[model samples]
Target: MLKTALFGLAAATQAIALATIQAKGSKLFTSDGNQFYIKGIAYQLTEDDPLAQGDQCKLDATLMKTLGANSIRVYHVDPTADHDACMSAFSDAGIYAWIDVDTFSTYILPDNPEWNETMYDAYASVIDAFHNYDNVAGFYVGNEVLTTGASSIAAPYVKAAARDMKAYRDSKGYRSIPVGYSAADIADLRPNLQNYLACGSNSSESLDFFALNAYEWCGQSDFETSGYTFLQQNASDYNIPIYFSETGCNTPKPRTFDDQAAILGSDMADSWSGAIIYEWIQEANDYGLISYGPSAAATATNAVGGYTRSGTPTPISPDFDNLSNHWKTLTPSGVSMSAYNPSASAPSCPAFTSGNWLVSGNVPLPTLGDAFKASGSSSGSSSGTSSGTVSASPSSSRAGTGGSSASAAPSSTGEAAAATSSAAAMRNGVPVIAQWAVWLGGR
Candidate 1:
């Protein structure tokens, strides 16, 4: 069996190499002729926290596989660790990975010969050690270095890092790997949009793709409405393709499963190069769909009410059923501006269970961990109104019939239990979420 797995890995690597992937026309395509909008979520190491309220059992990779998602943005890349096994899991499962360099400072300090040498060594080590991992798609050179611009800024590090790494790869005859960098959600947030966007030199050299991390905080409009379009316009001016590395918002609190899907799916459709959601697992701040709970969630009454951190999870998105409802209206229904109440803010929410430990203000949006608290204190009462019409208003938050609240956090465990109970429940007004679900089961 050991020999067979190794043989299978080698075969898989060859298959991945032979798989012709195209980065063209505002989207990507696979050899199988599948149109990829880069619909995916950022999976995290959050569940690894021993005291996390998450259900450990439900955190399964299979959930991502079933969602039709094509990629995952791993936040860290440590070459010496079991990264091969990590990348291999996704590779074998047919999921793409956008691996990130360990730190923002690494990319920014390239001008300093000493720091440059250190950064280069770390980068080269990972590229050389893990480049063979079939699932590795691209390198996310720097994270949000531009967000907190100052003497501490790391913009220069990018140019130097890219040059050094590319040179090293070429020296070793390393194969072609699509290179890229991500900007803080808004273009202006990045120190220099004009130059940063030029990281890939119009996708001609320094980079092959561009990434943006747009988070809709208290803004009345989707970031894409202003953010993506502006970048897309610039990319058009530069003739380069842009990928929204991360795009999501938190206005619909107690986020129903469908709402979760809608927020993520909408941005993907809105962007030209496609996008991936902030996170894949629940963190201290938000409910990541998958987790583990104690014992058998396989049975009905055996389930614990809340925060078991026990069962393995399966996730389902909030907007899983209402595919057309998402992002179709640039702003979500509950958090948009309106002619009736134009003065209303986008609505605020509380921090997660563990978030209390920090000095929390209204965070724009976290990197990829527990991204949001419940949508709003009003529980999505004041919906977001945008140029599009599908926006739901706060007046609609009432539960007209008997069931879950209109804005309950999406839960796959509920769906799983329902699944075993009867087929009739699934069809009879019960919401169905198409996203991933991992049952968290713990001791």
Candidate 2:
């Protein structure tokens, strides 16, 4: 029998074909081939249960529409639930969704970063659950995995999972659903990470897009003053689309959301796709653009990670009003994929710069770990072939001709082992992200 999600998709597709967004150069395009920009908010719920919040989602959809939100990014979802009603609410309100596949229990933490079949299966389930929904914009392969320079070793495994998932989608004949990563604001290594992910033409190995969870811009800041100029300059030559997966600084209690003007304005439009505000509901960290009120406190225990709420839902913070007012006059650009140069080669891979940890920019990344092989081979699974045939560099092409795709499997003789790196311990210089860990846990 068709599942609720599949049935709803079939019905919805027939009634009104929604545009599935695709990455094109530094921008995004829709099914009708129109250009689109994200004016979204990061949203989960005061109550953590995605399956049971259909009614609540519907209610929130109305508020989001009122705030002029065109999209929402959800950190996690229950694959087993019937999300038709909630998804429908968002769709009806003309809102799109970009979702995360990993959660706290089943995540690729830096301390013990290992990508195996178990992880693959869980991620695949997320794709399976949401692939049918037209309004579902994309999937985040991993959120802020490379939170520090030492975490660079996990890059290959994360890239491997992305390669495999894209292949699975292709195998099932799905559209070009953008699969990307959400990076933390580790300025020192941000450029290298972005360049590395987009270094190869083997589309399977490269992320379709890239996002940054940035909080640099606070009250009353401009492009140059806020360090956005540097970000713009650094990404000037990048081949893939990039945007703020999460933004909206929260230094002052009532965030004015002043960054919205510059983010949605003409200054950074060409270089950036757009932005998704940090959050919807207030949490202990207080980054929310809106407050659900103290009555929603009962759900706070499950909503946020670190801080416990003692008071009733505070009145909608002034940030929401500022955000709403700003969005009222904001006019996003139309979708255009024409500038996309399909023949353009990807950026050359960065040389392994010896940061506090070793980094390998080699392409045809290490094969699917031995643990994930269907045949139980000690090597990568044969099913994990890259979509593009070309290698990112001449040396990479000549270097033992690794995997079937650009993600070459390690040679039996250890000839191509240099292409792989080992995980590093979480030592000093690793940013203190207790709040981030807690927030991700609940999501």
Candidate 3:
């Protein structure tokens, strides 16, 4: 009887562990083959390692679960900190994490972008830190890196970062964690920037997924009027998973979140995966669904210009209830991985215009070391000279209901080894702890 009881408890623990999310063509799926939609919130408290606060994470995870959220997007974390407690807390609550690999100092700057060794080491260290966790959904290479037409010159470097990161993930014998980018919703940069990042003939060079930080749908707006119709139509033929990395515009007094219906509803679910709300806390930007500290102390300000509060998470009344209500009613059941077949062809690389897209469609992406190679070309020894066009194939017919048609890639077979001590950890010729100190001051 004692042995049976212990085995049952262990089985229950394993049952609750979050499954790995995989990108199938333009949609996302769970390891069990069920289609997955991200009902997520953007969670970042400090500019540094937010996940390092395990006690706070435990408290917030319970509140998020009550809010009906299944995922959280964390913008930054200390690669060297122990995340077992927080990650385990979220996983036990059936929540997954979509983390950003680049830190504030390591991110590629538009004015002076370069995919060098320093950036590569920083990104690789983060991956090494979190890749073992089953609850990690994916990693964003850079967020809003290219906002304007002139800044579009940095496109190639961004692509190179994705390429090298994917390569490092593969070479380390780690699971095939998806690597992607998040773009600012700029009218002129749309479709072009999206196409450029996923355009390369080489599958290795193309982003595993793409995301956009959109806020066009303000309070009390419908799908067609909010410009989401145009956004969906443009993404109808995209070949990889795409979603709203950051959303929820807070202009009017109280937000209604009407766009939530259109996003997870039949209108856009076929073309898009899901969305993550702009924020969790009421900061200076004022998009939080909840605030921290006592209700009377909500007015207190912090040194960084955000609301100053700590302790229990206090939901900001109607805003919290509004989002919770939408999530409760709108449950989208996407198609099963077995039934779906991906037919969207790779989009043709966008042509360059003087000020709009500075890089020519034919120009090779910037390369790092001898790791990157164009789809149909040889290995790259130098930078920006690799060449080849990934030929476009026939397009598939759009589905009326459920997820769009797309074939699922084989699930990752790599198993994580036991965690090693920081002193002994080494990857790509750099000690993991040494890299952490250089980039994050050993946070």
Candidate 4:
């Protein structure tokens, strides 16, 4: 008991003092009641734990500060690994983290989706791991889970993931860290997906926020020409905070990032929170603002495999300067939370349409122990292989959770068995039960 108490004290001391960002009626607010905007960049390099390397995180956090970024969206992280170094580094730099709870093996795939016990436990573990951090802005239950309209059948499972994650956060007595989803911005699935996630009467089940991976604004494009006008119009009355989970088109070279001006300017800042650029590293996608190694060694193919992520960082030419210039000039001071009154009501859930939207608004979202199976198998019972417990060691070869991975085998008895196994798993040499007790002691 004394050892656990000391551990809790150390954890508390390591936590940096960053204001918790909260979602309140179509806007985000800081602890002091000021409207918070997410001027962030996606910060995932390798498939494994990006934040595990403390030195690398410090390097990136320093550069991100120069770019005037206040938040970062990490696509994947190992829940078991100690994130104190990276989390503290970012927090000390006044940066917040919007972490995705799902992993390569644990996410809900669009074509073959499931809201099983393994997924639930994976999401829950992530929440438990980062809930203690003061700079954790939010957690994304899944990213681009439903890409095309044909795969919209998976909407219930996505919603269920959010519901269960939120419930798990509450059950653990953790701060109300926003749990939300990031969509792929499909035209046919437009307002339907957005409205469906935020519509339901049960606020507990509804998403705390919604994010879109929008890249409609190409080089030198205006709000209307880029289709942002339509997007702002569609989401004008949304009840929850919304922003771009991913953006920055690189097709026309140089990548001006004109959308930055529009997103932070008067046109959309009132309606939208803020946007996170596509990514930080100079990857194969060519959207990176900074490369890892020497300019000569940076290859256009498989940047993750080719570049050296360690030593001094190198800025990716005019692209980096362009984003910096935009951020330096555009500053949006949102309304104070104290004087702000939320009048927008939750939008009605979109009615199901064949081939476009499959999940009917009338049907209840898939429940873990009810309509949704624990194994995500067609059969009612699982095969006992799907424990949903993440390996104690993080996998380096695995792909990012934002993309698809081979599905796990089915499980038996679903939620109960998986939860029991998860609770038994060791974290930082302490059982989850004991760790929770320690966390509670700190509070």
Most TM-score-accurate candidate: 4
Candidate with top lDDT is 4
Candidate 1 lDDT at 164 equals 57
Model 2: per-residue Cα lDDT at residue 394: 14
> Over the stretch 1-443, how does candidate 4's per-residue lDDT look in tens digits?
00011364363343345788899899999988889988899887666688888888988889899989999988778888878778878987899999999875666656545555666878898888888788899999877666566567667768888988888888888889899998876777868989988987889878999998777888879999989999999889999999998778776888899999889998999999999986677644456678777533435453444555455668888999999999999888899998999999988877767567766673567655322232324543222223332321111222333332111211111111121211223336653221100001111
Model 3 poorest ten-residue lDDT run: 393-402
Model 3 lDDT tens row, 124-146: 99999988788889998887667
Instruction: Kindly list the per-residue Cα lDDT of model 1 for residues 302-387, writing each as its tens digit.
Output: 33233333345545355322222332433322221121222211112222123111112222211111111222222211111111
How does model 3 fare in lDDT? 0.70
Deviation of model 1 at 88, angstroms: 3.9
lDDT of each model, Cα atoms only?
0.40, 0.63, 0.70, 0.71
Cα-lDDT of candidate 1: 0.40
Off by over 4 Å in 3: 1-16, 294-306, 369-443
lDDT of 2 by residue, 1-443 (tens): 01243454364333335677888876788867777878898775522334246676777788888888989988767777777777878888888999888643445544334555556777888888888778889988876666555566556656777888888888888777899887766777677888888877577688889888777776777788988888888766677888888777766556777777777777766667788987776554455555555333334553333333222233375777788898887776644566455444578766665552334456345443421221223432222221211221111111211211111111111012122222221225442111101001111
Which residue pairs clash in candidate 4? Answer: 118-388
| Weakest 10 consecutive residues of candidate 2 by summed lDDT | 433-442
